[model samples]
Target: MAQGNIGGLAGGMGRFTELRQRLLFVLGALIVYRIGCYVPVPGVNPDAMIAMMQAQGGGIVDMFNMFSGGALHRFSIFALNVMPYISASIVIQLGVHIFPALKALQKEGESGRRKITQYSRLGAVLLAVVQGGSIATALQNQVAPGGMPVVYAPGLGFVITAIVALTAGTIFLMWVGEQVTERGIGNGVSLIIFSGIVAGLPGAVLHTFELFRDGSISAISMILIALVVAAFTLLVVFVERGQRRITVNYARRQGGRNAYMNQTSFLPLKLNMAGVIPPIFASSILAFPATLSMWSGQAAGATWLQRVANALAPGEPLHMIVFAAMIIGFAFFYTALVFNSQETAENLKKSGALIPGIRPGRATADYVDGVLTRLTAAGSLYLVAVCLLPEIMRTQLGTSFYFGGTSLLIVVVVVMDFIAQVQAHLMSHQYESLLKKANLKGSSRGGLSRG
Candidate 1:
């Protein structure tokens, strides 16, 4: 019996080993990404950029830097992060709906998808070049609060080198993401972002502790902030997993010799279907001007531009309102793009499934639309609350915690997804074992019958 138990444990351990291998592959890819973050773009003065970033604290710039895992502050090769790729994807998605040719390609399935992806890649490269050039130009003009240069050499050579390095870094990241998806577990791009956020946690925690030691924040405030973070994390888990189940009844049809009756199923619509994309998009869009303004030194002619930029700075009241609005709007917009009520209704109708008390076509579509609208509202509110809570804490409590709602949400969601994937692999392994046992038992019974 002891031997049998040992064998069972070994079998279970083997399954875990398989899962561990997959996770190791993912971890390896993430290590590569972190290494890339440290590789500076050729010709950049790392010391100068770091000093400038340290001086310009709290604003859209800070937010973007956080997303890039401090690489932006270093002016590293991966300073651009994956923003350009995301922007390209958004543009392509929009084009697929508006442009007839792209729409036709979208309808063509896998091959069309490949073509669209190619186009998106090209678009990403173009955006990276533009954004990189913009950043390089901004660096030349931007001055630290103490009148220090952010860039050592402010010439065409530096600009060109920075742009090329940044663009190449983004493309390399795109490749890394693809490799992770193909060879490892978890969505590659999401995992990259997840890793970045997780990496920053240590520094953010250290900063919080420093603030406490310096008496900048009260002990009670630290407790309050912890409580807020825990509450927000729990809230995000709830809303992210929250779903509305729409019941559907399918009337079965008769086959050659048998008659079939009705069956029931449910359609699950997640409350936060758009996930964290909206906040990222909204932040990136707003950060553009602020980033440029910081780069441009807020010169005499651009004084008005600087004022507007400051007003729209992250953590400010007006900026928060606009950011919130943009988040809500994008949540709705992206939700519509991914979930088409009309298409869902038509597909269900074609499959002979209909929601009880609703017609198969237009009425069902309307019902779905109504439900989605309500769900989106709830989701948007949850997002706003999670996002704004941290900002409020920063303002009211004088806490130095750098983790924001967007980062927390992404980290939590990605972790949940990673866990689910691992669990699924384990479940499959268990099922296989059970099947093998059943087959062995059947074979033994057959042999006994022969004896």
Candidate 2:
């Protein structure tokens, strides 16, 4: 897909140059983020922190670390990544439907969007503080089980500094993400997460190879893993691209004597309308209890918290049930929020279009809604199957099963989007060159006529 995007650039160095500049801009920004992933916050021992992560980051911590590009494992300033911002945005987005004031602001156009963004920023800052404070408090008790300290200096002073630094880091990353979206290529936050996951690919590959060689993973199992991953990727691409097209016909209109012909179009509804939002939301919410229990002074409540965390840990039956339910629920909820059949029916009715057999207004809306509900059901089931199967395998098979469906989903979708963006830039560049040549030719023809 990426190759196809850049293939037409052979005709003009200018387009290539422009594409290169955009790619370079994105690359440089990612480089900065990657560098920040290594810069540890004050009062934490980087080596010790990594060791602790190896010991404990098998669930929520690991998931967050992937999103942060391994910053969480490093206990770096960027440990929180843009999660605070993402969670904030999701909260505000959900609020739009729940709150009348937010709903009004949503319909206010570009100005409204800016206001919502500002609100999200504020929310992100607050979340950063809360999450950062949690990390600091958690660090106060972070021991390697064998008595090695993860935090070299742990106190109120350290906590305050850590919170401030962590919040600042998240804010900076938010700014970087904005810049990447405005000036570079693809979604910045997603790309950052993608970079982190892909960055670990080499090490994971080597580790798996080593395991296979050492008889830890048998030849048949290795072959099966590869085949399953390939099949899963194909399934994801197929479903992600799959769409249900509802045909609509527009009434003919006579403008200047001759009757105009009727026009036809189709409204495309994706199979997976909810996308990655459901799983991510589910994971974040489910991880909260464990995150809450990380406080150092929660010793009085430690036993209960530990039991709760254990029950909710990855591969646990309760965790699987809750996770699946949430994914399915959010799938429908977010799908409804995004694609309102009533709104669509109203817009089509206003525009003099009708879905062939369906009556206008209520009937059309009902038809659309019913179809959407069915699609969401199928999509949610797919989500549960794809996400849970991998985790189930990991629980039974072992911890080396790192490339879960969630990671694959993010990787596939983001890569496709990134390639699409690159293609857009390339197409735009080609058009610009064509316009310039046409303008020059017109000028030359005019000069010749004058002469």
Candidate 3:
């Protein structure tokens, strides 16, 4: 047993080559992104930007910067992060429902999807340019509360250069995200955000301990907080993995002779049909204004701008309400966008399949739609509860740690997806190994008979 264990790695040397390659690709891509986070844009004063961010501690873009893995704070080439691409995706998704041409394109299968993706990339570029320009213009005029100037040279020249650099950086990050998704483990964008959230966990731990050491947070309170975080983590995993499995029955069909084989399967619809996307979209959309206001504050704001910022800041009542509403809305909206009951019904009908009690055509579609609607409503409510309630409590508590609701959701879901991918790869590897062993055994048997 010991000898076999020692040789285990050698025996399975090629078993997970693909998985190893994918993991290496993801790790290398993220390392590149982290490196770029520190490589400041040429024209901007890196120190000034850092000082400004430090001075504004926990501002709107602070949360955004945290998610961007500090890209924004550094004013790096990748400062815009994946926001432009996400925004473009959201725009294209919304447009599909509103524009006939887009809707038609969406229904065109793989080729159509490629066209939509191309258009989305174009839209991302446009958004990146506009957003990059905004940041550039804002930085040019920005003065830190401590009187540190963010831009050394404020003019059209700086603005133009910054815009081009930032846009190119964002496009590069977007490409990296796509590559990660294609060649690596999890959803690329989500994984990027997950890495950022996970990266801060050690800091969170240290801060928590600091609070305890300084007698700021009582041991009981700290314990309670830990318990709560664990509870929420479990809840998220449960809800995210929960599914509504509808039994599907397929009618037997005529074969080569008179043989007919009936089939039974289940059509699974997840409890959270939108997955982690609704919250992500909601957070991204809400955070945009906060970012704008955070920058605009540096320009000596209007009362209105401050008011908007105050209203939308995390932990505020208005922010919570709007955030919750957007989450619920996006939950339904995204769920609808991704799932087509009519198409599902048609496909099932063509395959001679039906729900146990539902009739085959439009009836089945209606039944599925009804089920989905109820599921989405429950899911939206669950999302609001899990993602918002913690923020509200944390606001009331005034704690410093930020491993909050959305971050938790992103982390948990991404980890789950990553694990599933690993399992899938391992399963495939095992199958290959078994096939090779079987082939070897067959050849050995023929040789033994000859001997």
Candidate 4:
């Protein structure tokens, strides 16, 4: 048994080698992204920026920096990362539901998607400019622990330079993500975010250890945190992989001159159909107010804005409550967008497939929708627990834990997706090889018969 397992693993590894070019492309793109993280925006003092971030004491800054792969710490060109793109995507997706023209375009299929993507790119550029300008202007007012200005030349010239540089960087990163998705591995944008979060793991681990060494966090507390993380990771893996298989039966149908017998299959509905998207969307939305308050000197002084920012800060009850709500909301919203019950029912009906006892058409759509609603409700609750529990525990425990629930979820989900894609590619290659071998054998047999 052990030898067979080892032999199977060896064959799998050999098949993985067939995808070397794609793997290399993904690696090279990530390397370029990492390099960009170190290349600071022109005129910003990297040391002063780091000092300011350190002094700010890790709230929204830490969150953004985590997503940026530490680029925000250095005020690098990639500091904005894929955030603007994500926000733009959310906006476009929402618009698809609200606007008639957009809804019509959505039904137009591939060409429509391309147009929507183009719009998203345009929105990303626009958002990047606004955010970059905000960051640039904010840097002019920011002072490090030693009263050092983050921006040496804080003026219109600096703002323009920074804006242009940051916007260009976002566009370039967007292109890289698209390229990776088309030619390389799994979803490119997710991989980029995954690389960023994974990049920060080493430093986060070292920092946690330093805190423990310095007696900032107790040994018992450390152990508890580890246990919580492990439990949550296992829960996420199991739930993410879990699916409700709705069995569908297909009646006999005639195709061409042949009459086909009834068949059975399953329509798999994932427990968490939204995957990591809800948390990402929730985090991005929740961070917006805090980002405004954190960056704007004017907004910081306003009592109302300050109150709002404080209320929404991580670990705050309001923050957790709102975050949970948003996660659940986006989960259902995104899931609905991705899986249309009415459309699915129509397709199934046209294909003469129906759930075990459910009628075809309207009844099937209702039944599927009802099942999905329950699953999404449960899935959303699972996401809320996974995303908020660790933060709540860490806040209560008073540990300087770096990785948040959102980061962990993204890492795990992306890794699973990447592995699944790799396996799929390998299987496809093996199948093609088998077909070619069979064809070659048939050709040889035909040649011998002719001889």
Candidate 5:
């Protein structure tokens, strides 16, 4: 499927310099990001960090390392990745609906959007600072099983340096992502995360092989795991492409011989309009508290913080329940934010179109909202099942199984979105080529007529 998209785009590349440049720019940006992943921060012992991660073994840490393209394991500058930015964006988005001033700003147009974006950026920076500091403090107390400290020189100087390095790395990534969105292809942040996950695939496969060799998992279990992943991938693709189309009919304008014909179109409402955002948001929010608790619990030996961290650990009942609920809630919340039923109804009314058997104003909004609510509920349920099932399976398997449902969902959705964008560019190129040919033909015919 990916090959087909690339082939189609390449077929038309000769006539589309802009698309070619955009693709190249995206490639270059991703390469730059991958390079940054290996650049270690100062004052940290990368070897010790790796040893600590291996000694602790797989679970949340492994998942985070995968997301960071192994930067977390190495304690590289990009260890935070774009998670702080994502968390900050979620807070800002929620604020827009809750605060009157923000809601008004949202209503305001381009300038309002710029203000909101600025706010999100600032929030990201703040979150990055706090998270980076927590990581620095946590590292101070962390020691590998071999008795080597994760940090070479643990002091205020080291803490300050680590915080500065991490925050700078995150800020750089945010800039790269924004540039990609404006000058390249797909979503910058999502693509960054996608690249990290893709880069980790080889390592994950190798680790699984090691496990098999060590007799941690049977061949039959491995086969079953592969089949399950394949099945889930198919399920994700099907559901992501699923949509509910509402038939909209334009009112006839005239009743004479030259009367205008009524036109019919369908409004496509996606099953998961929120895409992979809900899970990302839920993960970010949940991880924030866990990180803080772990930091405090380890540094100060606080019993309460330890209990909180334990309860929120992945695969715990409370963790699973909260995670599922948050996924469903964010699914609804993000869907509402992205697709406003009232706005759609107003647009349709202005264009003299109405849903079949529905009134043209508020009633239309109500009907559309009803349909969307049902679809979102189903979609949210699907998301919860996809995200939680892997955790449950991992618990039962008693082994670290890479490519959990969240990772799989993210991989599939990002690829789908990227391919769709490539196809769009290809279509646009073809349309322009046809227009140019028509213009040339018309000019030639005029010259012949004059002769």
Candidate 6:
């Protein structure tokens, strides 16, 4: 019996070799990513950058640093992070609706997808150049609290070099993402962001504990915070997995002489269809102006530009409100990009599937739209609550915990995605084992019958 049990375990293990190999490839790729994060861009003063980052504290730079796994603070090669690719993807997705040629290509299936991917890459390069130039300019005028320059060499050459370096870094990250998609598990780009967010967890936890130890944060408060975090995480899990199922009936057609009745199926629409993108996009947009302000030495002025800069400053009530609004706006905007009611309705109609009561085309589309709008409203509220709660806690408690709602959202979503991938692998392995066992039982039954 022991031998049999061992054999069964071995068989299960054997079935998981493919998944293990894929996971190994993913781990290796992530290691490569972490290493790249440390490679400094040319013409940057690492010391000066660190000082500048330290001075900023819990500002927009912290968000950038968190996403880049501290690469931005170090002025590393991966300083630009994956924002350029994200921006490119956003543009290309938007273009599909606006440009007829792009729309035509989008409908071409696999070949069209490849063409779009290429276009996205080109767009990434362009965005990287623009973002890199802006960042480089910011770095030029940025000085530490002690008045030391952030850039080692503050010249046109430094600007050009930094741009090229950051642009190349972003391009390399794009390639890494593609490789992970092809050869590893999980979405490569998402995984990169996941790695960055996870990297900061240790520091955040340590700081929280340190505050508690020093009596800066009471034990009771820490417990309360933990409970809140737990509740928020649970909320995210439920909402992320929440889906509305739309019932569809597919009428069977006559084949030869016999006619068959219809069959029923359901279309599942996720509550949070927009995923973690809204927060990221909102942060990117908000951070750009703050980064610019930090880079420029002149802070005190009665001018409109200074006023605009001050209003947009991180930790400000106005900035938080604007950021939340942008997050909500982007959530709706991105949801629209991913889900088109008209297109889905058309596909369902072409496939001979219709909602039980709704008409095949426009009515079906309208129904989907209505459902999505309600779902998006719920999603927007959830996002705002999750994101704002942490910020409010940080402000009220005055703790050094730097984990924002956006960071927590990314962490939770990525972790869920990673776990889902692993479960899929395990489920596939189990199915294979069950199939083999069924086949073996059938063979044994045949042998007994022959005997």
* Model 1 lDDT per residue over 244-301, tens place: 9999999887675578789999999999988888887887788777766665663678
Model 2, stretches more than 4 Å misplaced? Answer: 1-11, 256-260, 292-298, 438-451
- Report how far off residue 334 is in candidate 6 (Å): 2.6
Q: What is candidate 5's lDDT per residue for 141-209, written digit by digit as tens?
A: 888878898888899999999899999999999999999999987999999999998898887789888
- Clashing residue pairs, candidate 1? none
**Candidate closest to the true structure, highest lDDT:** 4
Tens-place lDDT per residue, model 4, 214-236, is 99889998898788878887898
| Model 1 lDDT-worst window of ten | 1-10
Error of 3 at 47 (Å): 3.1
Q: What is the TM-score of candidate 4? A: 0.90
Question: How many clashing pairs does model 5 include?
Answer: 0
lDDT of 6: 0.83
Better by lDDT, candidate 6 or 1 = 1
Pairs with backbone N, CA or C atoms under 3 Å apart (clashes), candidate 3:
none
lDDT of each: 0.84, 0.86, 0.83, 0.87, 0.85, 0.83
Residue 167 lDDT in candidate 2: 98
- lDDT score, candidate 4: 0.87
lDDT of candidate 2 over 217-335, digit per residue (tens): 88877877788788888889899999999999997876977777799999999999989899998987888777655543347757887778778988899999999999999999999
Q: What is the TM-score of each candidate against the true structure?
A: 0.92, 0.92, 0.89, 0.90, 0.88, 0.89
Clashes of each: 0, 0, 0, 0, 0, 0
Candidate 6 on 1-451: residue-level lDDT in tens?
4744665688787857777888898899889889988888887778888898887654467787888899988989898889778878878988898789999999999999999999998988998899788878877877776778778788899889988999999999898888887887889998998898788788888988988898889888888788888999899999989999999999887575578688999999999998878887787777766555555546565356556767876668897899889988998998998789999999999999999889989999999999999999899888888887877777766655466788888888888888898898788878877777677778878999999
* Model 6, total clashes: 0
